[model samples]
Target: MRKLQQRLDKIKDNNQAADALAGRRSEVKPESASPVAPERSRGRRRGWLIVLGMVVFGFVFGELALTVQGWSGPDFSDARRVGKATVVSCERRGPIGWGIGYWDQCTADVVWDGGFSGRYAIDRRNFFHADEVGTTVTIGEGAGSRGGGVVFSRPELPHRPAVVALGWGLAVIASIPILLLLGGTFVAARDAIRGVSKR
Candidate 1:
C-alpha cells in the first residue's frame, strides 16, 4: 500500500512538472505573438507596394511622353536645307527584346556656311535607311544653331506610325495595374483611418 501511494505521488509530480513547463510555454507565446510584428509586416508590404506603384507610374508616363514625341516629331517648319553630305557611316541601334527599334543614327561629313567642316552624327527617331558608304545624303540645319549646330536629314527618315499606336495601347494596358494599386492604397488608408477613429 505504501509503494502504491509512492507511485501515485511520483505520477502527480511528473504531471505538475509538465503543467509548469506548459505554463511557461504559454506565457512565452504572448510575447512572440506581439501586435507590433503584424504592424511591421504590414509596413513592409505597404513600402513595397508604394515602390512598385512609383516604378509603374514613371515607366508609363515616360512611355507616353516618348510616344507623343515620336508621333509629332521635331518642329521642322523653321528648318532649312543646308547641302549634300557624304555618308560616312550609318547604323540602326534598336529593337530590344522582341522587335521595337529605338533610334536611327547616321554619320556624315558636311561643311557649314561658316566654313565649319567635320563629321556629324544625325541621330533621330527615324526609320532605318540602308545608306551605303560614299552615298550622297541631303542634310539640313535647324533655325537657331551654334557649336556643332543642329544637323538633320533633309527629308527626315520615316518612322512606323504603328509604333505610336502600339505604345499608346501598351500604356493604357499597363495603367490598369496602377489604378488597382492606387485603389488598394486608398482603401487601405480609409480602413486605417476608420480603425483609428473607432479606437
Candidate 2:
C-alpha cells in the first residue's frame, strides 16, 4: 500500500509540472508572435510619404514663384516715348519642366532708333502681337521716358476670346495633380500619427 501511495504522489507532481510548462509556453508564444513586423513596415512607408511630399511641393511650387515673377513688370501705359525700335528676333520664355502650354510668354529683341538695342519682354496680353523680325514697334520708358525699363507696344491690339478661355481651362486642369499630392500626403501623416498614439 505504501508503495502505491508513493506512486500516486509522483504522478500528481508530474501532472502539475506539465501544466506549469504549458502555461509558460502560452505566455512566451504571445510575445514571440507579436505583430511588430507590420508596425515597422508602416513606419517606413510613412517616412517615405513625408519625404516625397516635401520634394514634390518644393519642385512644383518653386517653379510657380519664378513664373509669376517673370510674367510681372512695371506698367508702361502712361510712360512717354523713348524711341522707336525694330524687332530683331522673336522668342518664347516660360517655366520649365511643367505647365508648358498653360502659360504663355513671348519676347522680342529690338534695335532702338539711336543705334542702341535691348531685349523686350511682353506679357500674356501682348503675346499674340509678337512682331516679326524687322517690324517697327514703339518703345515706352517709365517715369516720363527719363530713365527706366522700356516697354514694347504694337500698332493694333486685337481681342481674341477663344485663346484666353483655353488658357484658363488648361490652368485649372493642371492644378488637380498638385491638390491630390498634397491631400494624400496629409492623410498619410495623420494616419501615422494616429497609429503611434494607439501603440
Top-lDDT candidate index: 1
Off by over 4 Å in 2: 1-32, 77-81, 91-95, 98-109, 118-134, 140-199
* TM-score of predicted structure 2: 0.43
How well does candidate 2 score on lDDT at residue 118?
A: 69
lDDT tens digits by residue: candidate 2, 1-199: 9999999999999999999999988788754688898889999999888767756665565455433333333354544445555555555544365332244344556565556766765554333334455666565544523555444433343223454455445455546656767797799899999999999
What local lDDT does model 1 show for residue 64?
Answer: 59
**For candidate 2, which ten residues in a row score worst on lDDT?**
152-161
Q: How many clashing pairs does model 1 include?
A: 0
